[model samples]
Target: MRWKHIVAASLVLASLSGCSWVNKLVYRIDINQGNYIDQTAVEELKFGMTKEQVKFLLGPPMLVESGYPNTWYFVQYLKPGHDAPEQKELILSFDNSGQLVGMKGDYQPGSGFFEAVR
Candidate 1:
């Protein structure tokens, strides 16, 4: 009789495992990953600034493709406990001389971003 009770309890737990609401009973920590550059730092980027200057301001990029040395990719992702995840990205392009020339992706550049210092 005791064995039968244990088997029945096991079956009940196995069924509850697939229920989504069961997850709410457990606590989860917030998750933050990747290079998290703030809007102010990105706004500080100037068109004619060198790669080193950008790195100093925004830290290292998340990826630099092998053939695309002039492009830098910055990514940030965050998941707060049970809330939905959020992601932000910024792509910077440099000219042949390694001066930053283009910016794109989710981040918006500041007012003077396009005014190149020729």
Candidate 2:
């Protein structure tokens, strides 16, 4: 009877442990969504840059709701086969004249953010 219990326990443990290796055998492609902005691009942003200028640098934003025309949202989501998924966001606020005035979210503004583009 004790031997039967040991076999059952071993089977249960094996079944549980087997899942991890089985999962590894399957292939998973890395998934990337939305704009992929690098640090250099973020560093190029200037305080008074126009919407067109910002667009030229960072490309189109992920979200620009109709209700919030002055606010632009840049989002990036990355999922790897065997690693944790990562998400990044950048929110830019513009003035009534469509000039960049504020920036927020995961990314930090560059040192030249205070300087206007010539």
Candidate 3:
């Protein structure tokens, strides 16, 4: 009889442990909001594009390069899960000449800001 009680208690503990594991998995973080800009549209911007043109094409950048009126930066981020590293950042830079100079961060052409151009 004592062995039966022990077995039942063990089963209960085992079930609770399984539930905790499942809870951890189910409770994972989900990032639903953040700027989802198209990078391709940003890339398509030519060196000669005016600031107005850039604004029309990519919308306002997430953050502009500090103290650099001629430079512009576009950024975006995605944080999907707690265990999963946050997928973050897309950066596009334009030079003082009003031309695209450097681009870094995740540049998914179709997935990013350039989709609207076509």
TM-scores, all models, native as reference: 0.78, 0.84, 0.55
Rank order by lDDT, top first? 2, 1, 3
The numbered model that scores best in TM-score is 2
Listed per candidate, the RMSD to the true structure in angstroms reads: 4.0, 3.4, 5.6
> What's the lDDT of the predicted structure labeled candidate 3?
0.61
Best by lDDT: 2
Candidate 2's C-alpha runs over 4 A off are: 1-13
Backbone clash total for model 1 is 0
Please give the distance, in angstroms, between residue 58's alpha carbon in candidate 3 and its true position after superposition: 2.3
70-100 in candidate 2: lDDT tens per residue? Answer: 9999999999998899999999999999999
RMSD of 1: 4.0
Candidates in order have lDDT scores of 0.91, 0.92, 0.61
Give the alpha carbon lDDT tens digit for every residue of 16-96 in model 1. 777578788789999999998799988888889999999999999999999999999999999989999999999999999
TM-score comparison, 2 vs 3, better candidate: 2
